[model samples]
Target: MISIENEGKVKHNKSVATKLTPIEYKEITKLVEAGIYLNSSDFVREAIRDKLKAIKVVKIRDVDYEIAKKEVLGYYRSHLEAYISEVAEDLELDLELVIKITNELKKERRLDEV
Candidate 1:
């Protein structure tokens, strides 16, 4: 549920027939009828705002997810190789523990490349 300025109001949008797909328009109508939004315009505005917010945060267009993923997954992409190489050089010590920590760090820093 959204906190609208006027909860039970149907404020019309002063648009010149913005062409929404039939499914999109129907979904908005259903949400409005179910009281999920103040009105159709509010629903549309919120949807657009949310999408824009996601785009602003994640600049998906300029990002190269595939290249970054390969670079990240590769051994030499980060300083990660230094740690791995150290383990490889000193194979007498059990390296399994360090591998576990490396997996966790990958999950954390992968988003930065994005």
Candidate 2:
């Protein structure tokens, strides 16, 4: 078991056996030797954390999509204009997902591009 902390929140992780290629193992060992990571486990944990951050999983359903679309339109109504990135950050949505919703709204003549 491993205990990891992020943003003052503690997460407990279970140990799992993972196989690494020779080159991958060597690279991790080199990093560990250079003090970049405390150990191989630390290196692996950090890599997993980075990958998790890079990938976002959103379960999109018609109901959820409709709700998000309404929220986007509501935001545009209050603000004259907003960047896709800004809307995504403010609404706590994935950037690509927000872009998709915005594009659909534009096509439907509900939103205008400025």
- All candidates: CA RMSD in angstroms? 14.9, 5.7
- What candidate 2 gets wrong by more than 4 Å, as runs, is 1-12, 64-72, 83-111
Full-model lDDT for every candidate = 0.55, 0.85
Clashing pairs in 2: none
lDDT string for model 2 (24-106, tens) is 99999999999999999999889889999999765433347778888888988898799987787777777787899999999
Q: Candidate 2: lDDT over CA atoms?
A: 0.85
Local accuracy of candidate 1 as per-residue lDDT tens digits, 1-114: 334358787655455358889998898899999999999878878878899888732122232444433433453344444654354233322344435434655677642222
